[model samples]
Target chain A: MKMIAAQALVKALEHEEVTTVFGYPGAANAPIYDALSKSTIKHILTRHEQGAAHAASGYARVTRKVGVCMATSGPGATNLITGIATAYMDSIPLIAITGQVSSEMIGRDVFQEVDITGATAPFCKHNYLIKSAKDIPKVIREAFHIASTGRPGPVLIDVPIDLQLEEIDFQYSKGPDIRGYKPTYKGHALQIKKIVEAIAESARPVICAGGGVITSNATAELTELVEGLGIPVATTLMGIGAIPVPHPLCLGMLGSHGVRAANLAVAKSDLLIVIGARAGDRATGQTDKFARQAKIVHIDIDPAEIGKNLGTNIPVVGDAKIILQQLLNYVDEHYKEKHYKTQWISTITQWKNAKPTNNIKEDGNNEQYVNPKYALSVLSEVTKGETIVVTEVGQNQIWAANYYQTVYPGGFLTSGGLGTMGYGLPAAIGAKVGSPEKTVIAIAGDGSFQMSMQELGTMKQWDIHIKIILFNNYRLGMVRELQKMKYQMNYFAVTLEGSPDFVKLASAYDIPGEKITNNSKVKEALDRALSYQGPYLLEFIVDPEESTL
Target chain B: MAKHTLSVLVENHAGVLSRVAGLFSRRGFNIDSLAVGVTEDPNVSRMTIVVDGDDYTVEQVTKQLNKLIDVIKIRQLNPSDSVARELALIKVTANSSTRPEIIQIVDIFRAKIVDVSKNTLTIEMTGVADKIAAFEEMLKQFGIKEMVRTGMIAIERGNQVIKIGSSEESE
Candidate 1:
């Protein structure tokens, strides 16, 4: 059958099971928009191109699939750069399609002509400029495949206006046939055996989980391994939901904002088994001092990630599930009657017991405003494991990371690498869409939420059920905290003055909102917001003096 | 530490080179040299990078590279049997005082002067690592001021093509 390149793009996305796309219409990409209108795919018209890209990122992060975004050439395409880079940095899967000037005018510096392919080359996993209509289907399919597989990132396909307008015979193939894009999934047997050997020989071992564990859906296998070996498991911020928070062997989060016990365990362990984690700087805290006492064993699907940071005595390159399963089998065969160190477990238990308490001091006369940390603790207690919590960047993110208890995999979503503000609401909308059965909550700081407060319209438009808990300290709380710690508390531009009433703003978007100042009213307000939520916002005027971590 | 070859697939765009190169520079990863070009897919560009570090450090560098938004795929190529090539255009002073000596040096190195003006001559050379280093070192004496290198482009020896099909089939 004969088809146009723009039509092929839509067909390719359908094959990839992409149902919805976020984008803005433009002159350069009107042909694509025209083609899309005839297809079954739903196109969400975003107010801005940046919103479209970020919305796509949110969708991809929640669905664990390739999120699609579209924009026009020149300025429209350039606007998607930040969102594309955000997804790139965090390893989120996204496919961005941009409209380009005609092939004839590509290098002539004609009107609306920018070398978009060259502009986006470094930030995307792979990108293509469709010079021919015949290349459209293949390029689109490959772009999705490359973006969603292996380490998973954003890919771009720039379709020229002429190509989009040109018609060609289109055939949707079963799969791609590129010769250079090989990615290994199965674990190497030798590497698995070596990892088993390391596990068996170690006296004190701890399993460190990262975001990749969740990405690969290896949580169950990881849980089985940890339980069987009595290994204490600690997670990075991105790795929060890899193991159940209530599990006996779980050490919660590790790093600067991680639990004290978890950090202590990581520091003192004799052997560290890192699974699907790159051991990023935030998680390692002074690299030279991190795990100074431990021998590391790193397992990751991306071979490049093995031993990238801390030295790994055993490097197993493959998917986490495959590697863990192999290790489990190897251990079962070789160490059936192996002895575990009872003394080491007792020592860890002792360390756990010695950890400092998080009890909030309640002096009846000392009430000024709500402490953000205390408020988060309260939210944690009330929400427990029922709600999926999304956090904006900065102090609120740190507070959520340190205090929020996620009980299952895929429960917590945040902007980790780029730490983009205003990510909470839109991402929460996407998370809710992905897991419609769950109650989604967005915990955002006043400064951060305002950055993306425009997305409240998206939530309202989609009728998404999200409980937004805005910690309104009227400042960039995290920066202020940093200044307090290192900059002698001389506040700079971090403070906010006469900020818009978030409650009024939410009302303007046709969403219900409430303002809470007293600590005592937080639970009541949260309950009210959670109970009748199409998309509800609760602004908590938090104490500026409170530290998030 | 030994140097290793890393092949990275990235979106073909501007500033991506700087971002990737900047990362290595900032992280203290000694990149021996690097090259980037459009792949079979016009949207994708391949980067051939040579960096010096231990296995762990190299792994770390690749992981960081993977974290980059534009870097879609990265693979560590085997050092043996990989055809590595680099192109350099060096403009040196070629006044009557130094023209003949420079030409003789270029002839000895089998380098071609692609461009020439009154007082300057641009020599283009391509070779393996040692020869390029020697050629550059020799030209330094002729008051070489400007040099542009096409980093390094490489492919594995044999008829095998590192295409999309191989990558997908392996997965």
Candidate 2:
């Protein structure tokens, strides 16, 4: 059957089980929108192209599926850059579709014509500019395949407007088999055996988990491995949800902003079994000092990351979920009778007691001034079951990292590597779209929220009732804090000039919002906000002098 | 810092070079020389990258190159056992009096006079990067007008072929 190329794109999405897409339409992408309108898939019309890309990334990060987003030519495609780069830095699987000028006009620099695939080439995992209408089906399939496999990142497809209008003989079942792109899922048996021997010999073994564990959906395997061996698990910021923070063997996030206990766990260990984590600078502090005492065994799908940051004694390159299972099997077969170290557990317990993960002491005795940490702690408590907490970068993000107890996999979503501001709101919107059954919250700061406050228009447009929790400190608190510590208190442009009344801002969107003044009223306000369904916003007036540790 | 030459086999694609270059930049390693060419297999491209660093840099660059989806294989060319060549074109500002001296330098280096203007002589030479640099340096005495260097390319001295299947040897 002959069908419009744009319609074939939509059918391809349907074949991939893409139930939702976040995008903004323009003249170049009008044909795609025309086709989208006829499909059962929900199309979210975001206020900005950036929001659409970010929302798609958020959905991908949460669901482990290739999230799809679309945009028009030129500025629209340029706007998607930051979001695409953000996803790329964090290794989130995303498919970004951008409309181009007519094929004849692409290089002519016609109005709204930009080589998006070329522009995004440096950052994206792969990119393509569709040359013919006949290639649409296979190209779309290839885009999805490349986006979701082999340590996933964003893949872009640039469709010229003329190509969208062109008709093609439809064959929905046909897909491209990428011969060169085979991702290794199984670990070498020799490597697994070596790890088992290393584990048996190790008196103080620490499991360092990163986002790859979560990316591979290996949370259960990771938890079981740690539990069975009676080993303490320390997580990178991206690996926050791999194990419950409250668990005894679980050390909280490690590195600069990470708790001392987790950092100490890595530093003191005789054997560091690093799984899925890239061992970034922030996570390692000083590279030489990071797990120097340990025989580091790095496991990741990307072989490049194995010895990138720290020296690896044994490198296992494969899918984390499968490798973890294989290692678990090896451990069970050989070390079933072996007993885990008691002294190691006791030492970890001492460290845990020394530096507790959740001690939010209310320093502000005043009824009006709210402590950000205390506010976040209470908010964490009031929100009951199956809540996905997404946070903007900086102090609010760190505070959330410290206070929020992630009990489930994919429960916590934040921009880890890029540390991009204005990520939370759009990401929360995407997360909510992906998992409509769960309660999603976007935790933002006074500075970060305004960066993409325009996204409130998207929330209002879709009637997306995502709980917006803004920690209003009236300043770029993290920057100010950094200046005070690093630059001898020479404060410059960190303060927010004439802060917007977020309550009124939400009101402008016709959503119920409130400003919390007192720490005592945080719970009541959060309770009220969480109860009223459709996009309630709450602003916590946090102490400006106070900063996240 | 030790200088190492790496032979990287990659899928022939537009963005593969950019990704390889980007990875080096992100890691703060500068490429001393880079030469890319299509292999016998049209789908494969051979990249001869000369990087400057210690053992760590070679390890980092090799491992990172392998990780890229486009990169198929990588081999470090041992300078003693490999044939490396670089091409350089030099345009010298030569007059009737100075032409003989420039020609003498070219003849000594086995270089070719590719182009000539009334006042300029363009000489082309192929050798190891060091020899090309020396040839260019000698030509500079006659006031060189313009110059270009094609980074370095290498092949093993023996019968071993650098193909798609060669990467399995690393494993």
Candidate 3:
């Protein structure tokens, strides 16, 4: 009838139906690890705490469950900060547990003691510092609840070792009675009716979807609403797979370097319906100029994001899935046979035909090296738009966003908000672990790949099937491109010199890899890597001067 | 930008104050004055916060605070429709010569001498910020020794009430 807090935490994790966890063990976390060793949960030991965090996020993004990660106190907890911020910015539901010093030594600055709760307060949706063993059950339950609910975000828990050592008469328990924390799910009926009426009345209407659509898993509802009204859909980077990429009415991504057609359609549309999007600077170039002709309707769960950057004619604060479902229902009941004009569709199609957005040609001395765009196109062709494509930030992410086709929601995972360079490699590992049947790939730049390449060891250890499509341009190409465009072609410190021999590095980890150059070699190398049974790497010799255009 | 007065109801729990303060400080929103005390329900506490910001900033602050689990409700108290007051204690340098003068001043201001010493007379008063400011301005001529003031606390003028309703379920 009685147990230690460490054992109780494991029980809580089991009760929540968590099958996998990513973490590292240390002195402060010895008790928890001891109990974890006896539990049935599969624990992934990552090389760095950051990898543990990103891997957890990747797993969460794919499974839509609260991904759990752990680390010891002080340095280990500090290392998880970037990963926590990345997940927070992306609205991923995660449970990050960190070991703490004994309660008596918390403020005394003893060995491995740090105020992790204070450090993570601003980013995490909620955090707790466990002072008593009896509070562990309720804390874990509330942690999971707060993590996966309305607008999902990361939550943190810091358990002092002394508390974990305390034995109490603990029984398996339910969650806390939190009366003040209620989230509005279903939107107002009047607002739904108004939105439906607006869609019905508009001639040139466009639907813009964001990461919130994927988080809410409302891709089906969004398709029904937009396609029913014959409205073309333009997505942000995070909303890449909100609907099938090849759908006829899709304008693809719209923003700073978006598809020309998507941007043009949004600029010309009369009514713009923004669903689960914050309209960031990258997504909305020149806020004053963005969708100037459109009367926008913004729907999101977070009230702060409603009018953050742009003004909205109608702001609906509720879950995207619930609101989209209501809108679809209203449309079915009131105007089931309603048809919108095809004039706007014809105009967008003309733009799409004038220049295929995915077309990338080998230009400027391309005989020896692969064009980055060409490599991505081969990736798109080989994967058939059906694989999980996790991309690191910079030119690589932009290229993948430009060319890759997504077949399903949550198909593309990228660090859009925080834009951490080391995100892709570890996240792909997590994604693969979360779904073993699916093919997972980390499309990364050379500079970004090395940032978290330690995860390559984790992959070897776990025997996961993840293909790494390394675009080795031998430099940080995105920053170089920015400098070329803005600073009179002056480049300094952005180039990657003294970098490790990547193929040799992978081989050392027993991960077989092939070095690729020339546009013709890309398809064959990717095919070979993708066909490999276990983890494999393909390093592409991309032209250093190639920009993302 | 203009000054705003908001009354926040929060669950009486540890870390609630730190969470609220952390949010405001992290976002660079300056708090002019803050006062907290338990409400009629021992389970909940009331906080009056004054900040200077524009409409958009206030909306952002309100939305962010609402995201916290411990926060129950937030209502901006309108000056014209609310009765607000603050309590302050002031100690003035006093002697036999100025003792009679200070007593006359306290009588006129409706203040009471809570403590008296050889070189000082400590007076306590409860009133709106403007009234307290006027009293201090006049008493400063006699050379004040020390002073402490509680931030503003408010209630609606009449039958209009702001209630913190606890929902029974989440989602």
Candidate 4:
């Protein structure tokens, strides 16, 4: 049937079963907006293009589908750059559709014309510039396929406004037939066998899980593997919810700022099974010293990630879900006997038990400021470990990563790879929108909160119920801490002295909120926010001297 | 670091070159030289990238290239089992007195004089990089003017081949 390219694109979205799209409209994309107005897919208008992209990422994480975001050309497309980079760093599956100047004006530097495909090519998994209206369905199909496949990341499709307004005989395309793109899903049988044998031989075996575990939806398989073999699991920050944080065998996050026991366990391990993780520098300090005694068995879908950061003795290239399942089958056949890791587990337990206590006093806390760690622990307790906690970057992120116990898999979200400060609030909105029944919270520091605080208006407009916990430390806490450690406390631009009153700011959006200072009020304030059926903000006055550790 | 030549088969697309080049620069992998051209199949293009790195770097280079959606296959040619060649155009300062000597040197290197001016002789040479470098050295005494080279391209010896859906034994 002959129809405008914009109509066909919306139809293609429906074909892909896309229910919602986060976007900001502009003249360049007006035709697309007009077509979308008649479609069933819900459209969310974010305050900014970057917010739309981040919200899409959050939605993708929660829904386990390709998140879709849209923007016009020029500055609208440029605004999505940071969000796209953030998604790329974390391997989030996102499809960013952008409008362009008319095809005739493409290279003429016309109004609202920017080479978005070129701008985002370095980061996105793949991108396309649609030249023909007939290719919309094909490009859309390929974009979705590329975005959600092995080592999933963002993909871009830049459609010119002229093409959007053109009529075409559109026939819906079949499955992706890109000859150059085939992802290996099943691991090599011999490699899987080798991993099982290595696990059997080693006395001190540890499994380090990364974000890939959650991405592949293999948390249940991972949890079973851990329990079936009695192997302790240490997670990267991105792998926070791979296994329940409170599980007995779960070692809290491991790395530079990771828990002490996890680091010690990794140091002493004889065999390390690294799965679904790139093991970036943030997760592995001084590569040569990382897991020095361990023979690393790396399993990742992307062959490039196998030994890019750390040396691998046994490398299995395939999907994590399939490979973990393969390992589980082998375990069922050969590892029915009792685990030989009892002594090793005991040693790790000893190390975990002997870990030092926090420096904060256990008695009546200072009346002027609430301890961030203590407040987070209380937040975890109040929520019964069931809430979906998304954190902004810096001290608040680290505290939440360390203290919050995620009882369910896929419950923690953050900008792990990019460390984007303004991610939490928008991501919380996405998560809440995707899973309305689940309690969603955005934990932010005073500095990171203001980075995308305009998203508050988005929440009020959409009526998204997200309980925001703002940690008002009045400083860029993470950078300030770094200066304290490495620069002799020569602080310069790290302070946020002119920050607005967050509680009053929320009230401006008609979102009820209150500010609390004493440690005694943390639970009450958190409870009040959680029980409220609408968007609520609770601000805590955190000590500026508080350290991430 | 040892230098390794990787022949990658990719889809014939406009931005594929940029994708491959961008990946190298962003990942901090140094590319010594790169030569690309249409293959036997017009729809597929081949990129011969010479990367200077150790075993770890070579492995990373190959795997990262394979990650690009445009790339169909990658084959790292073994020096002993591959025929490598590079084409160079050298403009030598040729006066009537030095013309005979320059022609003799070019003849010895099995090169051809593609273009000639009163003051210069532009000689074309196609051989391995070492051979081209040696030929350039032979003409150095005659005062070479300018030179340009199409970086190295290679093919496997005998029936051994790199193609779509072929076994990765070559890699």
Predicted structure with the largest TM-score when compared to the true one: 4
Off by over 4 Å in 4: A333-336, A356-363, B168-171
Q: What is the TM-score of chain B alone in each candidate?
A: 0.81, 0.95, 0.92, 0.96
Displacement of residue B137 (Cα, Å) in model 1 is 8.0
* Ranking of candidates on lDDT, top first: 4, 3, 2, 1
lDDT of 4: 0.90
DockQ winner among the candidates? 4
Fraction of true contacts kept, per model?
0.15, 0.38, 0.65, 0.81
How close to the true structure is residue A462 of candidate 4, measured as C-alpha lDDT? 97
lDDT (Cα, tens digit) per residue for candidate 2, span B1-171: 789999988889767788888788877887998999998889988999999999888888887677666787788988998999989888989999999988998899999999988999999999997788788778777898888988999998876666564345422
Number of clashing residue pairs in every model? 32, 1, 0, 0
Give the alpha carbon lDDT tens digit for every residue of A441-548 in model 3: 999999999899998899989998788889888889999888888999999778888888888999998988988888877778888888888888888888778878
Per-residue CA lDDT of model 2 for A375-478, tens digit only, reads 77776667632489999998999988988877877889999988989999999999988888888999999999988889998888887879989988889999
Q: What TM-score would every model get versus the actual structure?
A: 0.84, 0.93, 0.96, 0.98
lDDT of 1 by residue, A165-265 (tens): 88888887766755445667888888777777777788888889988888888888988777677788889888888997667677878998777888888
Q: List the residue pairs that clash in candidate 3.
A: none
Q: Model 2 chain A: which ten-residue window has the lowest total lDDT?
A: A172-181
The C-alpha stretches of model 3 lying farther than 4 A from their native spots are A333-339, A359-365, B95-99, B159-161, B166-171
Evaluation by lDDT, superior candidate among 3 and 4? 4
